[model samples]
Structures are given as C-alpha cells and as structure tokens.
Target: MMIPRMLRCSVLLFLILAVTSCVHTPPLYVNLSQHNPIIDDYKALTNAGLAQRCCPEFPLKDGWLGGDGDVSVPLDATTTLFLFSDSYVGQQNQTKRNVPGTKIIANTVAIQSCKWEDESEINYFWNRMYTSNPRPVFEPKKHGNKFWVNDAFLLEGKLYVLLEEIGEKENAAPDDVFNFTQVGYTMAKIDNPYDTPLTWNIDYLPLPGFQHPQTGISCLTRHKEYVYFFINNNDRVQQLVRKAVTDFEDMDHGFEYFARDRSWQSGIETADMDTLFTGFRCTTVKYHSAVKKWVMIKDIQFKTNEIKMRCSPELTGPWSEERVVYTIPETTPGNEHYHENNFCYLPRECTQNYNSKSCEMVMTYDVNNFDLSYVINHELIYTPRVITIYLPVEESGGPEE
Candidate 1:
C-alpha cells in the first residue's frame, strides 16, 4: 500500500519514540580506584610538639591542650585554620580550679599544603583574635579569664568564629560549680591573613536549651541558605547536627534548631529536621561539585565506635543509606575514640578528566595521637595514621543495591 508522504513521516516518528522509551540511560560507573591520594599525612603535627604544659601563669593550674582542634575555611587559594585551645585547672587527684577561656590563635595554610610535606611552611596568625575584637574587652571577675572558641567558617571573605564562655562564682561553696556556658560569635576581615590584623569584630550570643552543654568541634559548611554546625552535646552520641537560618556572616540572625519538635536520631533521617532540609559535616568535603552529590560522614558510638559515609543526589537529601567506607583499625586496645576524622577529594584529572559521573575521592584521617591530651600528658602518643579510601567504580544508585 502506497502511503502519503506526511502519513509515512508520522508513522516513522511514532516508531522512533517507542524505541527511545524502552532504552535506559546507562548507569555512570565511576572508577574511583584509579585515582590515588597525593600521599598520606602531608603535614603531620603531634601533641608532643604543639601542646603547652599546665602552668600557674596560664589559666589552668595544671592542664594541657592539643592544638589539633581547628576549623578551616577555604579562601581565594588558601585554607585558613582558626586554631582553638583551652586550659583547664584540675590535673591529678585534685579539685578543679579556674581555667583559661577559649583563646584564639589564628593561622592560615594553603589547602594544597594539606597534601604535601612541609610543616615549617605553614603560617600561624597568632593573637589575631585580639585584633578582631578591638574593644578593650576583659572577662568579668566572676567568670575569670577564659574563653572557648571552636568551629569557624568564612563567608563573603569575612571570618566567622564561634566560641563558648564559662563563668565562675564568688563566696560560693567549694563543691558548687556555677553552670555558665554561652555560645558567642565573632568576625575578622583578612585583607591579608599572613599580615593578619590584630583585632576582630566580636560579639556573643546566648547558648540555649541543653540537658548537657556542648562545644562546636568541627568545621561548619554552607548548604544553600543554611549553615550546618557539628557539635558534641556531652552524651553518648557526642556529635549532634544543628543549623542556623541566616548566612554565617550575618550576626543579626540567630540559629534555629533543625527540627524543633523531634529528637536528634529519629528526626534527622525522617526529614523532620526543617524546611531547609539537608545534612552534612564530619566528612571533609560535604558538597562536591564534580559528582553533583553531597557526602555525609557519621560517627557512630558504641563500646568501640567508627566512622561511615552516605551520599545523596542533592544537599537536601533523601540520603542513600550509609556504607562502611572504612573502619578504624581495631589492632590495639580501644583504637576508635573521638569523632574527628578527615576526608578530601582528589582533583578531577586524577579521575582522568571524567565528568561528574566519573569523579573520585581520596580521604585521610589521623588515627595516631587522636586527641590533644596525647600531647598534654607528654606521652609518646599513637602514631595517627592516614587512611585513603577509594569508592568502587560502579554507580551508587538506589539504597541497598
């Protein structure tokens, strides 16, 4: 049968559409193994070298703190680490005395150095906080001279630092400890952080609603309109996720809880957290543009705790269930301790110039001298090892595949 030209064209189009509908997009199987980390422990600093001894001159009568506590934010081409340390009074079999509040010792290092071996090259922007806060600020006599700053971020080229302050009491009983812990915010402008100004635009905000008061432990990152804070609420599950609605640079805006009505564990997974729905931090690179995915690393605590990672298509996720990407070596007694670990992605070329689907990650976390105390005690601490994990080259799609 001879068909009209228009009718024949229509029939051919229909057949083509039918075949296209049946074809499935090939899954993107990224070969993560091909990419290797630049090296392990590019710049390793131990407590023995960084820790300051307990002395009467300092706030703590007999105490020490390891400078491992830092929050880093990437600026221009370098990563600025806001170093935080606190001194404690109680040392050995004795009642606790007054301690130094969180004091800031500012420093900046190129993110690239994080992949190389040069400790001396790194610059410490010390007493930079004193410059950030130009006001002749002095702690009230009751609280003593102590400040605890943790978890810092940079937004719009301005440094946003968060800290907690503890207060003391006078004419009070020996056993009576005044419960005074407040979260404060401060800002600094790094025209050239190498030549860091000696003052900051400092301010304090009240710490609210807690069975046990906590401190910020890790770097906070921006996801869309929200800033995510990773904290330890002084409980079994030491790490808790919190959020602030405004941009980190805006001091006027206060933080609102993620899911006001729900509890931590149950509420987060179920999407009850908030309207700005997303979860991240704990892992180094939360938002990776190459893969178009958000990676979340959770620290689970039991008798012996471990770290794990999960991925989602978007920052606000219906997250893929966590996979045990790596486990801390249980070779020694109680190897897994605190929740602090590191994760960083290899540059794109390392993945052979692959697109988002062909991306790869290379991460390193220090297991030796896992904490500041390792230095304070003057102990030959564990040699924190850096472990690199390569995700398989197959696309991770749909949970439990």
Candidate 2:
C-alpha cells in the first residue's frame, strides 16, 4: 500500500527528530535597550542612524492609528506610496483613527493614512462585486471581528491589493468558534493608490487551498514569468509559489495545496513573536541586483525578540543560515512599534548609491504587544514603524545552493 503523503511527513519529521535531537545552539538573550555602542559605526552609509524608534503620528485627533501595512509602487513618472491602516476608536473612547492622505515631495512619496477597511466596509465591497442572489465566493462575517486587506502591489500599471478575511461565527461557541483566513486579490488603475479611494477600481478573486493560511501575505518579487507569494499556513509560516496567470480565465481564481514535502526549508518558532523568540511572523522578499538573490527576514523573539534577516539564492533547498541585521535595543521599544504581516525595501533609484557596496532599506511591519489575553486592548494601540536597514551586498554573496 502506498504511504499517504501526510503520514510520510510525520514519519520524516520523526526520523529527523530521532537522529538529531542532540545538536543545539547556545541561547542568546537579545536586549534592545543595552545594545553594543560600537554597532552604531556599523550603520549603513545611505540611511545612517536613521533606524530609530518611531511612532507614526495619526493625522486626526479622533482617530487611533494602528495595524499599519504599506506597499510602494512606481507608476507613470513617479512612485506612489499607499499606507493601509486600521483606523478605529481607541480604548475608553479617547480618540479615533481615520485614513489619512498621501504626501509627495520631489521624488519621495509617503502616505500617512490610518484608515483602510473595516469589517462592514469590506463586506459591502465584496457583496457588491458579485451582484448575484447566491452568496458570493467571499463575504465578511457580521460580528465585530476584523480581517486584513492591506497587502497591495503594483503590476503592469495596475495596483493589486491582497484582501485577507478572518472570520468568527456571530455567536460562536466558546470552543467551536470559526476563524477563516484566506487571500483574495483586487486591482486599481490609478497611477497612485492614494490618488483615489481603494474601492473605486477594485475587483477581486478568492485564493483557495492552503491549510489555515494567515491573513498576512508576502509578494516576493516577480522573476521572469513567476510571482512568488509566501503565506503563513496554520501559523506555521510555510512558503509557497505560484506562477503569474495573467489570463483572466486561468488566473481567475484557484490555488494548489502545498504539501509538507514542498515546504520552505526554514521556519519560525511556534511561539508568538515574543515567546518562541525565533520565528513567529514569517515573510520574504527577493533582492535582484548584479546577480539574482533572495532574502528572508523573520521576527526572532529574544529578550524582546528582534526581527532578523537571512538570505538565500534559490527558493528550493539550500538556504544560507540566519544572520542578525538590527536588534532593537531595550531602551527603544522597537518591538512595541513593529509587528509582523509584511515588509518592503526602498528600491535603488530612490536613494543615494554613492557606494556600490551598500543600500538603505525601509522596512514596514505590524506592530503591537505580544500577549494574546490583551488582544482587543493591544490591537488598537499597535503602531507600525518604518525602519532602515543597510544591505551589505559583498558580504552577503557567500556561495549559493
């Protein structure tokens, strides 16, 4: 009898565990506050000392700004920055967070938007898309539950936004509650996303078949004919790829199930971004320069658990080990401001290339407190930060598998 694939994965995991349960690395406790002073000299030349603790100031007084995720796209003669955020009333009804506006200065574009989409708004938008009597392919649950629709990208002069729906039954049982997380994509035609409301030119398709894929979506650059997306399945943070199916029919709406055998070679620890202290929110992006290369950055939970960077040339098998890029010092509440979800680096044309050896990167991350018991309270307070990381190309070119 043929062994089932799922069981085979279990057996393989057992064997790998049975053989090498002994090897281990010394635990390193990373404190963001008492960091080494000399590391300051190691700052990248382009955005020197720019990676400081920052809290995005919400533009409106009534608005409480949090859950900030962003995508930067180049269209026409300029680059437009679209920042999608969770705008709502804070605890105690002290303030409100509304979607702000986009700011363009010279060649740099920055969007200070706090409002993106709420549960009702998305449901209304999705409902109107189908215009059918039968229920549509996607719909948001009517509870006060929330879903993320923030991952947006630019392809072929159109803006593609990945909408994530996480649902819960209106009156779910204490144990039998339902949480559905799937990725659906939509596109807009405006040269800049902030130029118009996201709902104006949006049309969507639901992505299917991946085990409990988290609401977070990663767009790992397009290579020739393939566009890779890294999604966290069942919070295990599995990596999967899909070729660009631009044809309306072929690309309409379908996804293949990625078995364990086809998993990304790396993983974040099972703990939250704070406890497991290794891998929690896993996301990736490819840096194509003189030679093609891919880099993966994950939240490495340590004392405060820092977000670390690792690089690999090829997606399948053989990945360069993990390395620490920037550890948020304890004095600075880096983790307090940056959470998981997604991150994108500022491209070459936008910054100083005086030195061919290095380039500055501005990273966007989901920010909030770690404890789940504090879910509702923490959600509103979560603030996103854009930090700069200097990528040293020469040192990172250490062979490829």
Candidate 3:
C-alpha cells in the first residue's frame, strides 16, 4: 500500500531533525561495555539466481522473490533456512498488482537455504518442496478464500506458523484486494524442513483470550520454559505476552501478558499490557548468550528505511533506548526513490557466534517499494538484503581497538 505523501514527508522531516540534534554521545549501552557496537553495511543476497530454476521469473524483472515475513532457522553451524511470508512466483509487476486480469501465483510460504562460506560470504539455494501450486503444505481456506503464512519458526522439532486470512471484498476497489485478517497460528510436525519434496502433518490452533479484530502475533521467541510472543494491534504499539512451554499445545489457557508493573498477569484483557516499542511493525527478538542479553530488530513503523535496535538484560524488562543501526539510503523519504520500503529482521536461531565474546548476529530483510504505480514506471527494488551486526563484548577496558 502506498503511504500518503503528506504523512510520509512529515515523518521524514521529524526523523531528520531528531538525528541532526543528537549530541556526539556514546551508545545507550556504553555503561554495559566500553567497546562500541560494530554494525556492518547492508549486503544484498546475490545468490538468488540459483533459485531461478524453480521459478524462472524469480527476482521478478525488477522485484524479488519474497516480501516481508523473514525468519531464519539454523540447520547447523554453517547452513540455515530462510522462510518467507506470502511468497509469490512470477514477474514482480504481475504478482504485486491488484488490477483486474493480473495473474497471481501465490507460493504461500517459500524456503531458501543459505550456506555460509566464511564470515562475509553466503551461498543461497532454493528448496523446491515449497514451490507448488497452492503450495500443498499448510494451506488454510476461509469462506472459499485461502490464507497465507505470515511468519514461521521451528520449536522443539515442530514447525509453528502464524497464518493470515485475506481476500478482496466484493466490489472493492483495486487497491483493497490485499486487505487481510490475522487468522491465528498453526503447528506442523515435520521430520526435516530442509529436505526436498517434504510432507507435513498440520494442525490449527486458536489463540484464546488474545483474538481480536486487528491483532496478531508479529514475532515469537522462547526463553527457559516460556514462549514470548510480540503482539501487534494494527496500531503502532506492540505488546509482549508469554505462555508456559508445557502448555504450548494447550493453546486455550496458557497465555499471560506482561503488564506495566513488569508482572505477568493471567488472561489478555485483565493484564495491563506494556508497550514494548513504538513505531514498529515487523519485529524479531532473540536472546544472546555471550552478553546475557535479549536483542531485538525491527523497522520503524512508518519510516521503513530506518531499522532500529534495542537490548535488554531480561526478556520482559527495562530495554535500552533504540539506536538506528542502519538506514537504507535508497528509501530515504525525500530521495529520488523515496517510495520504497525496507525492513531488517532476524530469527531467534541465526546467530552463529554466540559463544564468542563479541556477538555476531546474521539476518535478512526485504527492500522494495510496494506502490504498484511506482513499479510500472520505474525498475522494481524488491529483494532480501542480508546483514551482519557485531555487538562488542562487555569488558571493563576502554573501547576495543
């Protein structure tokens, strides 16, 4: 959906003013460690050409294979699986358009395998098992319309996915076809997701006490015996809620939300949910062992180009102020190609060097402007951009040389 120009401009101006006025002060976590955080530049995943065999049109003319919903699952020390949400096959123009007669090939969920050759290089390969008509795995139909996977992860050897049900309303405008409703989560038992031509035994589960008109889990993570889910309410604010690990299969009565006082309360409505972060849509949270902290990466709600990072000593705790780790120059709100949107998100399992004193986190994100009109006239900028972030070790000495 295209953001209104007036609103976009206002946000851009506000961010610019905010950045310019900041003093040359140290990072918020400077007290935890004297060494500065090392953040690398954005690296575009170029190995997408390997996936062309499944869908020749991949990396669609101007667009890329998938949009949003990026969650990386580590298969081993060097191999990882990247799962995409609402993935599609075909030219970018045809797949993203809502006009009449446009061909839409919905892949539902797409998988890509990545192998790390070294610290700075990765090779990508497509998994054909996920590229099927209607995508045989985990397809939910509601009132004759099919739902798509929004996000997924492997927990205790089972694949858990959040599904969204969406379709064009009768006689709706061309731009309204993509409107969707959060349909909740589903679980599937799979021996190995990386294996080609895989089979899945899927089960749908209801999110009791948390279901509402425009609310759904944006991202999830497990700490100790609890699974934390970041709930998004369509509005900018995100709430943190958790459920007992033992009751994961018993969805009906396991959820408890974190309240303003930092205490867990039973029932969603009874809990005074605290806002985790503002101006965030797609989000991810992971626990880092090296620093004994929880790290989060998410795109600023309206300002997609800016990816913010935050850290906390505990899962449900006093988080540090957000720091703008990376900004996509191409999507700068007032730039030539200002309409483009970008996001940087990481899965809970993708960190390879957690034991190292310096934490190195690897993740992928999408970069593309969703405006249909912009794509037709200009080349599409839709693709997943990979990046690595290094968090300095917590040492008593001054900044690491």
Candidate 4:
C-alpha cells in the first residue's frame, strides 16, 4: 500500500475534505409557543388607573400636556417610554386650542414610572430651549414638521425607533388631511434610551423602499435571536420582515420576509412575502411566555369601533382571527361617551403592566376626533383608553411539540 509517499498523501487529503464537507453547523430554531387570547372574558383595567397619567388630568409643566400616537415601549423592568405624534402643548388654562395658544408639535416623548400603585407618576420631555417654543426631541433634520415617529424596540440595550417622513403635495393647502405622501422612513438609534430623551445621542439611518404608500411600518418586536418588524400591508393585511440580533447597525441588508411558501427567505418582494393578519395597526406583536402565544392588539380604523386581540403559534403562520377585546365606547355613536366626531385607532400593548400568572395584560387605544378642535375642547378625545385582557387557561390551537 505504501507504493509511493506522494500518492499516499493525495489519497489522505481527499478523504479529509469529504468528511469536512459533510459536517456543518445546524440551523438555529427560535423557540416559541402559541394559544388563543380569549376576548370573551375581559374588562377595563380600572384599578391600574393608567388614565390618571393621561391628558389634562396630569399636571402640566411648561404647558406640556398629553397627545395621541401612544407608542409605548418598556425600556426595562420598571419604566416605559411613550412616543407621541401630533401633540398639543400650549396654554394650560385655555380650554380651546385656538384661544390663549396651542401648538401641535410633530412629536413628543414621556417617561412613565409604571408603578400601578401610583399610575400618575410620569414626566414628559421635549426640547424647550425656547420655553414658549418647544421643539421635538428628534426634530427633523429638514424643514417640515411631519416626522410621524412610530414603532420602537430595544435590542442589546439600545433603542431603535422608526420615524416616518411625510411630504406634502405641491399645491395642497397646509391643513388638508389627505395632502401628504409618505416620502420615506428613517430609523433612529439611541445608545442611551435609559437616560432622558434629551440627553441621549441619536444616529439617524435612512431606509428606502420601506415606504410603500398602502403599507407602512407599525410594530417592531424582538423574539429570540431576531427582531421582527410588521407593517399594516394595505390596512387589511400585515406583512413581516426580520433581522438577526447581531445585525442592527446595517439594517440595509439581512432581511428575511415571511414568504408565501411559509418559509423565511431573503428580500422584500410582496409576491414572495405572506400576509399574517387579516387587519393591522401600529402596535406591538410579542410572545407572552405565561400564555405561550404570540399576541397582537390592534384596531383597523373605519372598520369597527372595537379593539381586538389575535394570536398565532409561530411568529409567521396560521394566525387566529381577532376577538373583540374591548368595544370602544368613545366611538360608539349612541353611547353617552361617544361624540359624533369621536374615533379611535392604534391599540397598543403595554408589556410593563402585564400580569404573567393570570395571563392578564394591559392594552391602550388612542382616542381622537375628526374635527381637530374637538380633541382640544373635549380634553379626553385625544387621550388613551386603557383596558385589561385576561386569557383562558388553555383555549386551543398549539403547543408546538
């Protein structure tokens, strides 16, 4: 067999290469569970008194009051951040927005002391260098005050926020409701989200083609080794895109969409991606370990006057239809609380207020009015409607063996 040393070396090299090719790293499996979120059994979280921290009820400092777009994110165990859009901060004593003075800023932020015992403990912040003229915390680097900031999530202790860039129509008036176009999206990175928003440093990263007029960025949730982003794909459908935990700085690539084949694939082609939910909103979609279901709370505007809950076994498959968790009393025409112009949207999940053992969780919806003045005069129209959701022991569906 040792006919020639050179020939023997060549034979050994071939065998080693064959063995190496056969041995490869196994694919990663992100462990998750799923169950039905029973909406039939639920009620308002009246005890939490989350309402105490809302609107004119909370004392105003520097004319800083409350606003809509209640995009709440739990930074850590005990604190939560509220990112708002089209907020009112003007004359605290003036009941009417047109009177003493009222300025509707593009955005503002607040820090909540999530202690249900004292739900009133929350402080709002924005740049007030000119006390009478406050600027948004992350003011647009451009001229327009149309940065409708949405969906924020934390990964590796850093916060990432999605700011929608809106552009006005060439000949349209300033106050026209439908005169704006979604120009683009920018993701802001905050290395110190724990500190006051004013003290934190932000790096704005521009993202193109992510702005589809019909579908827009809404929810940003992290599950296992990946952070998943869901968009209200044309109001009635929801689409998803995700990146690895190690891929934050370069969001330009490494995106995986929930494909039509029910498999995760690279790219953003709508034909390639699958719609998971029948309806969507700019809300949180997360895994509740206690209930073992990936749950999302949302309300499709103009569809119905109810905030609903939907769930799925996996983050990207066979999602259950929504069950009405709370019928929005403020939007119901005949209800005493209802105003002719009153409406509600954007049902958000408050993770910090979640109670694990009993499968109890808190959700909030942004109340608004078609007539802008109604929000200012009514006081409660532009605030949040907080409710409590309690799930059953084991409704049905999957355990994902």
Candidate 5:
C-alpha cells in the first residue's frame, strides 16, 4: 500500500496539450466578443496575485502528520472536505515525521469548517486497527492494494468520491514514486457526508470495465443533465465522456464518449480514443464567473517552480496553450529556505474562495523532494502552499476552460 502519491499529476493539462490528434474540427477558441463578458476584455486582464497561505505547517495529530493529494470539495459555502493520499500518520517528532515507528497510510481526509474564514478548523480522519495502528479511512477491498483519492463532487446531498486502487509494481525501489500501477477506478458513495467520515455509510463501487483503460479519477464535472469524466491514457490522448446525471445508480452503464464529430458515442468506438498517463490527473476544473470559462491550475511538469493555466470553451475542446501565470519564489536561490530538490506540484484551485467581482481565485500546491531525508527536516514541505490568480474579463465567452 505504499502508493507514493506521485501519479496524481495534472494529466488533464498534459492530455489537453495533445488535442490536435483527437479533435476533428479547427480551433475552438470561439470569438471573444461573441462569448459575452461581465466587463470589458481589456480592463479585466489584471495581474495575478501570488503568495503563500497560512498554517506554514500541517496541523498534525497522532494519526495524521502530513500528506499529499490535497484535492478539496467545498461541501457548502463555508465547509470543505479535503481528500489526502499517502498520508504520514502514526507519529511525529516536533516537525519531523522520521520519529521511530512512524507509519505512512494509504489515505486520509480532513473536514474544514468555516473555510476561508477566521474560525475555520481542519480535522483529519483515519480508522484505528486497534488502539495504536491507524488505517486509511477508505481502505481498499482488493488484497494488497490501496485507495488514492481523486476529485469528488456532491450530488443531492451525497458525496461521490473518485478513487484509483493501486498495487505495487514488481521490483521497484522503495523510494520510486512510479513503483505502483492503478488497479482500476472505484467509486466511494458516502450517504452522510456531514457526519464524521468515521461514521459514514460508504459503498465501494468497482466501476464496470475498470481494466478496459487506465482512467484515473483525473476529474469529474457536471453540466445540465450530464456529468463529464476526463479519461487519461498513457499515450497522451485525453477523452471526454459523459453519463446522464440521473444514471448515478447505474454508473457502469449509459456512458457516452465524446466523439471527434462532437457527437456522444458509446461502446467500442471509444476504444480508439487517446490518453497520456496511467493515473488520474487530479486537476481542479471550475467555471470562473468573472472570466466566464472553466480554468485549470497546475504546476508545470519538470518546470517545478512555475504555475500555469489552460482553458477551453467546452470540456471537449480546442484548449488554449498553457500560460505560465506565477513563479514560486521558494525555488529561487537566496530565499530563506531554498533547495535544489524543492519542487512544486499538485496545484489546485479553491473554487468556493473565488471572487467573481475581483476575478481572483485561490490556489494551492505542495513542495517536496524525492529524498525522504530532506522531507523529514522540512515539516511543511507536504502541506498545501497557497497563491492567487486573476483573469482578464472578456467581452463575451468565446473560449476558455
């Protein structure tokens, strides 16, 4: 169950980068004027504000020290549920987790009440094997496998969590993040999300044909009657698929693929669709009322200190090329705590905190290195670091993600 939590890269951006191969039409960057915006397009283009957000360190408890995969689901205007993966639970010595007997669990979760407000509180959850041994809250049923969380959304008071079951890859070095492969896509249906996750009534759903393709819970979004899923393939081709909102009970059936002709197709027709990664991309996709387009925030792969964005008029689109919006100052030399191994990752947007009037949105990412030795000394390395981005309001929405 040692999933290194590295598979959650923003594959959506990577796959979206390969759009020309699958799309049949020309650029979908519809005319800006025709799209309709709340403000003049020129004035709306304000510079983004980037800075680190608080806690500087993770609030650790006996079973929750620090972890990665901080994808959040805003349950209400003031409440949010954060999903974490490959958690460092069990123990810590001051800021370091290298204390004796410290253990790393597959996953954990946190509930933030009054989020974005001064009174907010974050509480992490896990199950106890007895008194001392803690296990992941959503433990996988498959033997020798672990559950790593993906994006989740609330529908009709229920929480639907996207998960990928992973198992160790043969002969991988202990520190290798790529030492595991996805077992398949799984759905965790929580009946009472408001209650403590420990008391949650959850059902583990093994998605039908989970092995047909290596689809990570990269992202799950909804529009009108259909909920869309972005599928990732290791070849770099991304496929958009949808199922009716009413078909939640029969999730295994009724899935329709977005075809090159803009029609929804089904069955073997999707067999030929392209993909770019073996795991889900955990990219946060949300509509910015100010910009009037869905925006995805991510840290550039290999270009660690930079944060960038890509947008599309529609999910199945001719996505705009990435634009680097911010550069992390920590990676720059001469900063108080700069390291050659300090790389940024897991960039995700906080949609509830978005202010349409100011056209500003909050975002977070984690900084880490491959060396556990370095991480042990930097207690805050795995905690979520924050930033703010602003978009230029357009005359109308011709195209954006």
Candidate 6:
C-alpha cells in the first residue's frame, strides 16, 4: 500500500503542525492585584494627611523617601530585613546639620524589618520609626559616596553583602563610562542587624574574568553547593558565574564562569563566560522545590517599566524566555514621570512564596522623577508593590512525551 509522494509529504507536514501546536505553550498571565496594602498604607500616611510625609521620618526626608537597593535577608521564618542604598532622611531639601553646606540628609544604608505571624499578617518596622532614637544601619563615609551595597546572600548564619565601588560621578548617564576598580563584600552576624555603628567584616574579591569594566554583580543565588553571582555586563547581557559554597569566603580560588558551550571553566576571561540571559539587572533567582525549578524575577533593561519572570531546570541553565510579569504605569513613556527610571526588584526573601502554587511577590521601585509635576504634585509613589503570580502546572502526556 504505497502512498503517492505528494500525498505522503502533505500528510507528514500536517502531522508536524499538529504536534507543534499541541506542544507550544502560551505565555503565563501575570495577575496584578487591585489592592496593594503596602502602597495603600504609604498613601494613607503620606498623601491623605495635611502633614504630607512620603515615607516615615526614620529613613528619608520629610518622609520623602525613595532608593534602589533590594537585597533582603531572612533571619527566621517570620522575620526579614531589607537593605537600601542612597537613603535620605530628615527634611527633603535640608542641609546636614553637621556638614554645613551639604544638602544630603543621610548617605547611609537603611534597613526595614518585616515581621509576620503568618504570610497575611506582615508588619513593617523601620529601624528608627517606632524607637525613641533612630539611626541608619550602615552610614557612608561622606556625600557623593561611590560605594553602595548591591546584593546579599546568607551562608552559615552570616550575611555576605556585596558592595559595588563606583569610580564614576554620581548620576552619570547610563551609558557613561563608569569604572569598577574592585568588587568588595562585607559580612555581618545575622542576629546583629540593628547594631548601631554596626560592626562589619569587609574583604575584596577580584572581579570575574569575564566581567567588563562597566559590569557589576546584580544579584546572588545559592544552588546545590555553589553560590552564583549574576553579572550585569555593559552589553546588557546577564552572565552567570559561580564559586563553591565552601570557598566563598576564600575568594582567591574556586571561582568559575559558565562558558558559552555550557561547561564550567576556571577563568574569568570575557570570552570564556556564557550569556545565560539578556537584558536583566537587579535579579533574584531562587529554587522552587515544589516544582523543582529555579524561578527568577528581574528588571528587563531593554523594556522600560516592565518586570519579567524566568524559570530554569538548572542553576546555570537554559532559562525560560522572559515573561512580562508586571509593568509600572508611572515609568511608561509619555507618563508624567516617564523620564525617571524605575525598577521592579525581587528580594531574596520573596522566594519563600516560590513553592506555593499561588504566590504573591512584593517588589520595590524608585518613585522619584526630575519632572516638576512629579516633584510637586504627585502623591508618594516611591514604595514596594505586590503582584500575584501562579506557576504553570505541568500537563500529563504531552505530545513530546
């Protein structure tokens, strides 16, 4: 029963189309919540009152607070601490009482603690808000400080915080030539987060060989026995580099880069590292045990006002394509504050919800814009927002299977 050649070819083409249709999965829908309690509370305190305080007085000006660092460390099941950079406190436009001419209120690393009996009952406490005396967790040397904390990871009951030392002028254009002289990290005891004049153990580590002069370590993640540093290179590509968990503190050795061919190699040469994903900055990757996958939430550099989610089966992986999980109306082009940059950064603590089938992730972004309208008329928009995302369930007996 030999079929005619054209008929056979047509039948094969139809079969292939059917299989492809069945195997192709549609993009996951991101569910933005109608009500974000955190933002609501912020609005109530800052916008609804005659006083008009954008944030609490403890961390930033008149409470006109906003900053970019999203490194979070979970101390226990119910307690978490969030770290901030370029935090301002006191009057929005006031000179530091001590530094005569300097208008910067506070050039320090600020922290906020979130305590919860359960997921639904979380309470946030600023370091200085409710206390008789308030202070920043980590203070910088002076105004226009170049060093700022970027990301952190917990190991052996200690927190390792990565501090990026910038050799460029403050507020330089994104494309400006910024020099990264050295990449250093510091450590603090997990239990001593609130120590005044906090004691920190500092050390410097050589940048990964593949790192470009403009590249910086955006985030850190732990998988199996290694700690992976996600590098944001000048070309807007994300590179994955790793160091054995045991040698993390050693820094002089045991570091390797994921090469283009997907193999681990012991060098930092730009040519040796592989590009795991592109257009990612300020990312957080955590393992989802329930689904046995690594889930990453990050800011898409190429896509303004958009935050994306990616999943992978391995640490250094064939990561899933970026899915737009959330977008900010304020940062969109033509919007009132469109000129200002916005980022949706996921803290490492948010990974607690990763295993849940239905999970809500809270992300933070800067709400400041140089636009006159935003500075004078806008309500306090600098705060964290919550977004709910559901991981896709695997269907049984797929066409490929």
Q: How close is candidate 2 to the true structure, as a TM-score?
A: 0.51
Name the 10 consecutive residues with the lowest summed lDDT in model 4: 12-21
- lDDT per residue, candidate 5, 1-401, as tens digits? 11122212222221111000111221122111222221111122222111111111136653467888787776544445788888877642233477765677888888655423233455667777324577888878777899888777776667788887888888998778578977777889886777767778898877765452444346767666777777655424566777776877576688777766667777424565433222224377776544456676643465356677767677666666676766665576776657777776777776655544444456667777767787776677776665555554543431222
TM-score per model over all chains: 0.47, 0.51, 0.66, 0.78, 0.77, 0.63
- Candidate 6's residue-wise lDDT over 1-401, tens digit each? 11222311111111100000011112222121221222111012111211111111122333324444545554333233456654434343432323222222222443322221211222222335423343444433443335556666566545566665444455667654232243333332233333321343434453433333444677777766777878777647878778887766665567788888888888565656788877656467766543456777775454356666777888777887877654555567775545544433342324432223222233444444444244333334334333333343342111110
Off by over 4 Å in 4: 1-62, 91-99, 114-120, 170-175, 396-401
- Backbone clash count for every predicted candidate, in the order shown: 16, 20, 1, 0, 19, 6
Clashing pairs in 3: 279-301
Error of 6 at 401 (Å): 25
Q: Candidate 5: where is the Cα deviation over 4 Å?
A: 1-58, 61-63, 91-96, 115-117, 210-217, 271-282, 330-336, 396-401
- Please provide, for model 2 over 1-401, each residue's C-alpha lDDT reduced to its tens digit, 9 standing for 90 to 100: 11222211110111110000111222232221232122111122322221121112222222222334433332221112333433232222233333122111101113321122210011011112212221222233444334454344455444555545544445555654133333343322333333323233444444443224442344444445445555554444444544453642244343332334553232232222121112344443545342245556664443343556555666542455556555443214453434442222211111111112323344544444434334344433344343445454554352121
Count steric clashes of candidate 1.
16
Instruction: Please write out the lDDT profile of model 4 over residues 91-140, one tens digit for every residue.
Output: 53434454455777888887655334333355666777325777777766
Expressed as tens digits, the lDDT of each residue in 1-401 for candidate 1 is 11222311110111110000011122232222232221111111111111121100111111222232333333322122333333221222222222234222222211211211222122222332223231112121233444444444454434444444444444666544233444442333332332322333444443333222333333345665556554434422223344544443444344444453434332222123333222322434255433346665554333233456666675434566656555544322443433333221210101111113212232323222333443334321221122333333234331111
Q: Name the best candidate (by TM-score).
A: 4
Best of the two (2, 6) by lDDT: 6
Q: How does each model score on lDDT?
A: 0.32, 0.34, 0.46, 0.61, 0.60, 0.45
Please give the lDDT score for candidate 3.
Answer: 0.46
Best candidate per lDDT, number? 4
The Cα error of candidate 3 at residue 369, in Å, is 2.6
Q: Candidate 5, 51: how far from true, in Å?
A: 15
Compute the lDDT for candidate 2.
0.34
RMSD of 5: 12.4
Native-referenced Cα lDDT, model 5: 0.60
lDDT by residue (311-368, candidate 3, tens digit) is 7887666676776655555567676545544322332224432223223344455555
